[model samples]
Target: MKALSYLILIPTDPIYVPTEEQAETGADALEALMPAAEEVTYDMFDDVRFIDGGQAFEAITCPLCGKDAQAWWHNAMDKAAEAEFEELECTATCCGGQTSLNALIYQPAAAFTRFTLVATNAGVGGLNETDLTAIGVPLGCKLRVVTQSI
Candidate 1:
């Protein structure tokens, strides 16, 4: 059966690119927030490709200008994928600014570890402020909350 999952992207840094120390702290804080929350690394999403419609990306591309920044992005992701562990990360090479890879889409993008709080019984609408605050504040990072029913 499919279930609605609240995918909360809690990066160690506010910009979404976490340092080694911050990632570790965020992980601990997350577990403290929800003892039942299962921790996962980017590898869990082994073959996820970012495709908005029918297109597939080979690497990071500009979502707004639709430019190919794969070469630059590759270097960034390799360095940032799993900061506390393996470190897969990226900034907007195309945008020429501090845009986190977590905020952009990648084709064949490396999976960065994050949290998923499943509201199996309540579904998406049931998520509340208490739920948001509990997860957000303790982590000391911004929360990218999105729902996935699967």
Candidate 2:
């Protein structure tokens, strides 16, 4: 099967949701840059939700111990899903330290967000710092991109 790619942008702050206007502005900026994208979309969720990279996903690391936490990550994800991801707190198996699942470093990048702007099949590798700043201007917040392929 051919892999499909999505470039997803989210607020740096996990729980932040951009206003409709802000979201529109960000989407416009993204579309302008990714003119060849198959589609662009804005999604707002009532509750925080996970945006994973599917087959592109890589290992997750413990924030406290900096060890591979892939073993613990799935169980934590299942537990968090039980509440629709309203709660992300978990104890790291590596160090037994308290942390939010959102704090774990995903290799290919993932996040918990209430809002997102996505460009499908964008083809570009990733946004540069200048491009990120350009898009962030209208959104009025720092942003991060997660590249998902499946």
Candidate 3:
């Protein structure tokens, strides 16, 4: 079987979601940048969802203490999943600091978002920062890109 790769753009703030029109504009902007992309789409969810990087995912770290937070993150993910990710708050074990799962630093860039703009077969390894900022303009929010292969 062949692997499929996706380039997903999500808001830097997990709780922030663009309006449908804004999302469409963002999608259009991304399409303009990746004209050879096989597909481009945007999705909106009623609740925040974890947008992981699939095989690209690596270790996670606590934003507070800069320690390996894989174990803590997993447990917190389970708890948050119970609520369908409606709540992302958690307490960090390393520093005993309170934080949100969304704030955890994910290797290879995973994120929590209620909306996403995705491009399949993006046709390029990555977008430069300038291109990303251009795409984010119409969406009215800064974006974080997550590349996933599955």
Best by lDDT: 3
Q: Which candidate tops TM-score? A: 3
lDDT tens digits by residue: candidate 3, 58-113: 77889999998887777899999999988899999878999999888998888999
lDDT of each: 0.45, 0.88, 0.89
lDDT of 2 by residue, 15-93 (tens): 8888899889999999999999999999988899888777555689988989999988889999999998889999998
Please, what are the lDDT tens digits per residue for candidate 1 over residues 1-150?
Answer: 644343344333323444445545555554555555444222112222221212355565665556777767657755654354233344566666555555555553322333322322232333356665555565555454433334
**lDDT, model 2:** 0.88
TM-score of each: 0.37, 0.88, 0.91
Kindly give the number of clashing pairs for every candidate: 10, 0, 0
- Poorly placed runs, candidate 3 (over 4 Å): none
Q: lDDT winner between 1 and 2, please give it.
A: 2
> Model 2: what TM-score?
0.88
Q: Each model's RMSD to truth, in Å?
A: 8.4, 1.9, 1.6
lDDT of 2 at 101: 90
TM-score computed on alpha carbons, candidate 1:
0.37
Whose lDDT is higher: candidate 2's or candidate 3's?
3
Q: Could you tell me the lDDT of residue 78 within candidate 2? A: 97
Worst 10 residues of 1 by lDDT: 42-51
Clashing pairs in 3: none
